[model samples]
Target: MTEIELNNEYFEWMCQLVCNERYSRRLSYQKLLRHLHNIDFQYMLPMDGNRAEDGIDLRYRFGYEKEYEGSTIASYLDNSPCSVLEMLIALAFRCEEHIMTDPDIGNRMGQWFWNMIVSLGLGSMSDSRFDAAYTDDVISRFMNRKYKRNGEGGLFTVERCKYDMRTVEIWWQMNWYLDSIL
Candidate 1:
């Protein structure tokens, strides 16, 4: 099959997977093979440099590496009449709650999420000249501090708050702000 055809088949499979109701035993290798067989497509299992082990992981790997640079899943989803904001929120929840809890993986996930927001042209308000309007606020909330000047014109620092704060609280605040706008 041509690359485009493979991509379309993959996309359809992803949509089905996302919309599937059954979570338990839904993502097994057999299930994937069955789905592909039903679609008349044969899976060419990856040998090396695949980066991930499963269909979902492969899709995410493609997205993160910008293999689909000009054309993105977010843009496709945005064309729908339904709110794409929910999708973004779901992504945020996964990143912040599930992925970001790990000290090793948290920052990478956060950076990836931020990059996606920036790429979709959803980073800032329509009338604003800034790349993102609420980025500083979000960062401040995440760090649990007020923004302070560092004696530099554009450089600023966060002064840590006295009260102890949890990372989850900060994530929630960021998610809240994102939900309000998008």
Candidate 2:
């Protein structure tokens, strides 16, 4: 496929994630967050070296949340592929350049990432370690810290942020699967 076409596909996929809250709202909270954190999103670039929606509500309801409420951290980590979050990271890695160049796109990814963390649980909000994740000034700068709803308040300001792309290299290596897909 041509570069533009590939980029378009990538863009639309993300728009769905941002626009269609139904899927995101129903994500497996703990599983999604864990998966999101593990995939390095800082240096991954698209094969070709390749937008925002509305709210950032970090709420969830899904397979694990129901049957796995009492699941321990170990179990949650080993939770069978939640699919969505990891898929997102893979996409980010595939289209890193396209995503990084667009502040809106990067911010949305950051929004999605932060929302996933909040969706995990309110306890994560108060944890200092959450803030520690972006201690790297570059990673911290590309994210959005003012994404609260009209009056939702930034109770978890540190954790509720999203990436704005900026000029930083916030992506890691692309997923191996992208080799054939691209």
Candidate 3:
């Protein structure tokens, strides 16, 4: 496959791994996939690369099957632009898929995916409403630890948070979120 084709395949795979219809009321699966593709396209890692590594590690830690249509993270990152946001979003999907036990939510993982997007205030940035400036600003804030102590703009926002969600890792923040809703 050509470079563009390969990138498109990889993006579609990642979107499939993360997209869920039940939780996508604000944004459809197709729009979410396109948005993720855009986000990944614009993503540039920091000098240290710790954050990128962390997000990649999280995706792997979730044990997601990455051999999609003959593409892996190595191949995808080898060609396309690098970004943690999409990977982290995928990680959240996997985490909720495996960890959360909320039966009422039906598709728990899908709900968690949208919840995180909504938590970051990205739900309204649909295809028609997508503004790169707003998307970039929110993504930068998220990666740079600019979210509030209680995780106002982060993936998991806890009401009356006991721990500083920005300082806390995503795993623990997810746990906090599960606890909060339970």
Candidate 4:
């Protein structure tokens, strides 16, 4: 998988935060994990009018219960390219079996990924659309965010992605609610 250049501190901190709250009920985190749980509820399929708050069973782990270790939001982000947009789209694509013809891939894993993408603001789940170029564009923006063009306009000053203090601080604030539970 191609990695997205990221402010590693922001991305890793988000990863670690998700990891820590894999069992907790952080709102945004849960918003991102709604579809990875049990099928007993059987709320509508992801592509069919699935909402962010839909499929969210707060008490349950996003994937299998603690009894069996399985996929979770933590694992999804870990496998991603570090761009939120790319990560959501990429993971959704990865879980899909029919990449070109369908978006849901007609399976539980696919549904979960699709729903999570919708919840996390990736795109419309109802639309059966996929774009490789858009994914590339998103990655480019993320890569460009870490560098500044030189006066020559031909070169860039490579500041690196991981050390972005602003992103790290934003993540810190976004996840501040977790501190109370931790």
Q: Which candidate number would show the highest TM-score if scored against the true structure?
A: 3
Candidate 3 lDDT: 0.62
Global CA lDDT of candidate 1, please? 0.33
TM-score order of candidates, best first? 3, 4, 1, 2
Tens digits of per-residue lDDT, candidate 4, 53-162, equal: 22222112323333323333444323422233223333333334323234454333334343443322333322234344443443343323332221011011112323
Candidate that scores best on lDDT: 3
Backbone atom clashes (below 3 Å) for every candidate? 0, 20, 0, 2
1-182, model 1: which lDDT tens digit per residue? Answer: 44555456545543443323232123322232222222211112222111112223444444564455434544432233211222232354455555455566433333433333443333342232332334434433323333222111111211242222232232343333334333
Itemize residue pairs with steric clashes in candidate 1. Answer: none
RMSD of 1: 17.1
Candidate 3 per-residue lDDT over residues 1-182, each given as its tens digit = 46566556655666655564545454554654565545652222343244345445543433245444334545544443445455565555556666865578554555677677788878787677777677778877876778888887977899999888877666677788888988
- RMSD to the hidden true structure, all candidates: 17.1, 18.6, 4.7, 19.0
Give the clashing residue pairs of candidate 4, or none: 7-161, 8-162
For residues 1-182, write the lDDT of model 2, one tens digit per residue. 44344323433443444333543443333332443334333222232122110111111122133242333322333333223333443343324444334665444444434433342232232323334344223222323323332112211222222332222222222222123233
Q: Which sections of candidate 2 miss by over 4 Å?
A: 21-182
Q: Which ten residues in a row have the lowest lDDT in candidate 2?
A: 51-60
Report the lDDT of model 3 for residue 85: 50
